[model samples]
Target: MNSHQPDLRAAVRRLGRRHFLTLTAAAAALAFATDLPAARAASVPELDARKIAENPFTLGVASGDPLPESVLLWTRLAPRPLEPDSGLPDKRVVVTWELAHDETFLRIVRGGTATAHPEFDHTLHVEVTGLDPGRPYYYRFRTGTWESPTGRTRTAPAPGTATSRLKLAAVACQAYHHGYFTPYKHLAGEDLDVVFHLGDYLYEYAVDSAGGSRAYTDRVLPAHFNREAMTLADYRLRYALYKSDPDLIAAHAAHPFAVTWDDHETENNYAGDTPENSVPPEEFLLRRAGAYRAYWENQPLRAPQQPKGPDMRLYRRLQFGQLAQFDILDTRQYRSEQAHGDGWQKARPEAEAPSRTITGETQERWLLDGWKDSSATWNVVPQQVTFAQRRDKPTADFKLSMDAWDGYPASRQRILDGAEAAGIKNLMVLDGDAHVGYGFDLKKDFQDPASRTIGTEISTTSVASGRDGADKPANWDDLTQANPHLKYYNGRRGYTVITLGTDRARVDFKTVSGVTKPGGTLTTAASFVTEAGRPGLTPA
Candidate 1:
């Protein structure tokens, strides 16, 4: 063979075995589609198969942020609805959406159609704008003869529209195998303007990690997912399974969700390139790229969140008129490793080591700048994990999880100091990931009892993670007693409903009996209020 021809053959071989397999699969698919159902079999009428198969919007329709003139409409067109788990073939469906002033959609304001391609799981995100702000609207989608359920949504108040009040429900940590999402069902019923999911919307762990434990008994999941999610298909299945939950669906249909992801969205204790399982560098990048792509495909986020390789830009700002400005941060992607031995091991006292960061340099600056420049009365830091420093102090034997902000003490203090220095009063940090609810004064230092409180931090418990329950250890009581800065602590599974106004913001901790039980009741377990400029939490 000629040298050039030999090189061409080598090049083809270098395309990798997986690529070759994919080509074979594609060819097989084409052959199968052509051979079967050129027309339907006599057993099933060709017309019926043709007719039924035409309807594409099988997963249902959802709309977020219903402005007076525009709304964000989402739908996944499933050509094979019954075989929901199956990937879409080479097919395209046209999704027609309409927004109306009323639920009946009698007065349609905006109407358009977009093509949903199989590559995107036939999902379409139509962010329609040009409507009035701070108004409720109803929307739905149509594909062929099928129609999705109409969803209700409301837009943000026009920028700087000095609103008197706004209600937002904050929640996070929904482990699929842990329990039912009845808490979401309750939240869907609540009268709220917006919902904020701090992080851990889905766990990356396999089913067996949960084991056949207390709450995992009745849990149902996709047949696969025995390993950590690494492929786009794996992520899609994970999301599909989560979205199938009635409560989760209800909540999405009920209110717009402002979301961020914690470690579990990609991998446990994941910090940029370092994953908990120690994925090899190149392999980890590939996995991250896949995970990020799938996340963008499923979430109702704006286009900016579309991932580029392994990175998805999740940190952004959401405004609720002049009442509040929510600064959502991605804490997992830019952080140092957790301290070993329960995270109590202090970093080496050297400048470089103690200076290890959680938010990285750029994100830290962004957060601080956003806080400083905000004009809203309530500056809400919608972040993942507890902001207060965990004391593993005199007893070096005791250690806290290094995965959290506590592990980066210097960085945490810098954030607190930045807010204080910027004169950004009324700072409220809403966090999740501890699987336990906590109320703390965001102080310069938690180790020092006399540290000045700069703001308030409310760490909401998980929605369905098994770590949350009514049971509390006696040691928890001892910890609270020792730490006066910690006002309250609970291991209940629930969320926080926050109501913000000009003078004060109230956070109501809504607790659920248990996540394993479907349709569990929710009640306000505790409530805290922060007066404007007070910068500290007061009992509501």
Candidate 2:
């Protein structure tokens, strides 16, 4: 925890007292909803006898979606995770939780009870509030005599105050079958407020069928993961398998997370109502709904983000005092189908049509409105897909990925224009999903370098997607030289760390030497800084 203890009374004033009261009421209601597990034991003797003998916290504990006055704590009850139904009797279980000022529970502040219903994969999310802002809190959950791991989470600073700095790590695309989560173990030790998982939290396809750059080298996945995740039970089992990773659990316990999904969470390169495979629209929707429900059950998101059928509103804003504000966007949900069905496509007339949208009209309006109204010093857009334009060939003809922002030129232009019109000078865009690191300046017109530099974009690589990736991939030099705005590129596995100061924002491209094996070393491959007013990347 940062030791600079600001005045709690002043912090309360910044976080309005009325809002504090409302949060207290919400927490109380969550506590009142569940009856004690011991109280129900006598009535359900059979279920009690089959009580979890082994540790149900194998998947570990996580905390996320922090606010000035509230935060969410999450844990799933899984005694035998590899089993079909998590090896538990089909019954609702009462779970107890506590938030404290210190790691030890001696100085407890708030405690509550929640029901982990089997309908929701026995996952629990407790929304807690009325704590002092910009400070660390320790939280843990308990079911009967079994207890979860203690997780450390920090709340956001009071909304409108001028905090000095904010630290965050951007991570994505961890394919469990490819390699080990060694990078996440390194991330767990960093001093960070949050980990923005840009997407691909867990891949949905089979280990062998999901053709990546390389084969599985770290370890063999459980037998259940050999198949694709199609049903609700399959999705739940996949999440359990990923959560069982120790390094990933460590990262979750170390800090709160704000996450959004990419295509692989459900199916490869899926658009709004269209799946990558040629499944019928009706059947694909059912699969999508199942994936969405499983994602919600595992993450630490609040009730508002819960899915209603196939529709779930995930784009939202998180503020860190007056220093920084993050607008987390969901690009996979309401996007138009990939041009030419997911490959390099010529920039044609239809591709540039105004009707073609990557972010649906509603989300586009919401993002533009957020830019227009945001008052923070540094505004960040944490989203999936590469925001910059990358040309694959060196010829006069432009070739780019139809699945990325390049495919929707008109929509991208609108966002850049909105930022410029709203006078958002310190705009920063962070993304993941390429399985490669990209450091570049966001040009108003990607094709023309003479155009204005509107912002800086730092796209982090995968945690472990391309196993032991080559340092110099095919056409790497040609592509970097062709696109002069691209400051740095790395094919190795890693995540990017961003440190936001009042005057400047520094981005460190942290890479692990290897991920195919355990205990790889961490190294800073490159570092770039963007000054407060200037929106271009400079080698730091």
Candidate 3:
């Protein structure tokens, strides 16, 4: 490390915190911004197909961000996925894609050509339009003689169509070193209209050369992946490693996913404009820029979701006719730092500060306004972290997860109060993280068991982060006893299935027996039904 670096950071910190961060963030990405067009300008570097040694579609293909009439298709040309440059030359390659009505490509409907520039890591995104609403479409990409794996995607129901039903699966937290992606394989086979990946798509931590917990004896991974991701190339390579999993690829191919990121996508428990460790904000912003850009290139996001410097607008709404309206949130990007210095802590005055916000002012306003005008029968919210309050033990001096909504009392209160004011009768909240499944009746006052059940929150277990977990965790009894609002709890590796019909909503807590080994058994641990105009969980 440079001896003078500390002095430089100290000088930078003298300026106003908010304004200085904005300036430094822009400064950090200026060079990256200026370099993109330079590489894009030298775009004509085509070579004969015979000269290429192997197929470049090793990463497979995916489609996401579905609309009533359109959906985005994504694929990267990665003959060698873990390479720094994805093993592709610094040239633009013309990739053609076809959307067909059948899996065999027997009936081609939409076709187009897009240039996959190395400036954007040779990823291709084709937004297909002019399609019938509430239908399935098969798509694939081709360049020269090589073709990608066929992917199936479905569009949302038409607006005001009075849809009778909607099916969705929520998943997240797939750390490669923890276990195998067995849950995704099971999820791929389930009949769902759409999938929502609630973040932590990939961890920033290092993986062993033997492929971490999987302990791969068949092959050894590269040494570059044995360290934390810190640079743009590092983050990109990390994504390639996670995406190369066959089960994850299969899940993407099976259904279009709407995704949002959590802390692990950049760093663990990092708050808005604040690094988890004691790292300088300027340095963290530079790292965040790389993480954000790599996220955009890899995911099947549209142009509107693209990143600028260290910022990206990932929060948006997706409606499924009149059955459900999903307000996808980005809580990690705008939350205040973890109060009381991380981990579980008792309530503190700083945590209750009205000025300390989880969703920044603008996003809070957006969410409130969206709720006020919502028309769907079930107003669903897919966000990071737990919503209901969770205490450590059955006592008045109980501690709570400082990283979750429990630390942001004021923010949670505003949201809960807003729901009641808007006359939101059937409110549903889907949360990720915790590495365990929890069904909570969101209440206005946790101290009172009879408090109004303002909403319902179904928190899904991790995909593979916690390895093979048991049904009853060590603190299961304590957690269930202390928090009366918490109706269910299970420590397992799996996702959750949420189905909305015309009159009611049902949530199934799906659990996998194991993820350390292949072919884990998937079973519904529990199921709950909440009737329309009644915000509570009833055993189904």
Best by TM-score: 3
Q: What's the residue-level lDDT of 496 in candidate 1?
A: 89
* TM-score against native, each model: 0.85, 0.90, 0.95
Model 1, runs deviating above 4 Å: 1-60, 63-70, 79-87, 208-222, 341-354, 392-398
- Candidate 3 residue lDDT tens string, 107-219: 99999998787767888878899999999999998888898899999999998989998999999899999888999999999999999998899999999888878874465
RMSD of each: 7.7, 10.3, 3.6
Candidate with better lDDT, 2 vs 3: 3
* Model 1: how far residue 204 lies from native, Å: 1.7
lDDT of each: 0.71, 0.83, 0.86
Per-candidate clash tally: 5, 0, 0
Better of 1 and 3 by TM-score: 3
In model 2, what lDDT does residue 96 have? 85
Name the weakest run of 10 consecutive residues (lDDT summed) in model 3: 1-10
In the range 1-540, model 2's lDDT, one tens digit per residue, is 111111223333444445423434322322232233344545642335236788888899999989998899999988888777676776777888999999998899999888776666679989998988999999999887798999999999998888988999999999987888889999999999888999999999786533232344444445666788987778888898788889999999999999899988899899997988887664566577668878998998998998755567899999999999899999988998887767887788767888889999999999999988888899999999998888886677868889999898888989999989998999999998999999989998887888889899999999998776866777798779779889888888989999999999999999999987778899999888999999899999
Off by over 4 Å in 2: 1-50, 208-222
- Model 1 agreement with the true structure over 1-540: per-residue lDDT tens digits: 000001212322455435423434323322232222123233322122235445554455565533334556777765443243333454455667888899888899899987665556667889988988998878888766678777778888888798999998889999877887878888888898888888888887775533323244454444565566666567766776677667887888888777788878787777767766654554554566567766777777777776655666788888777888888888887787665633445544431265678888899899888877888888888899887865543354545546777677778878878888877888889999888888888776666768777788889889888644874644586657656788878888888888988998887888887776565778888888988877677888
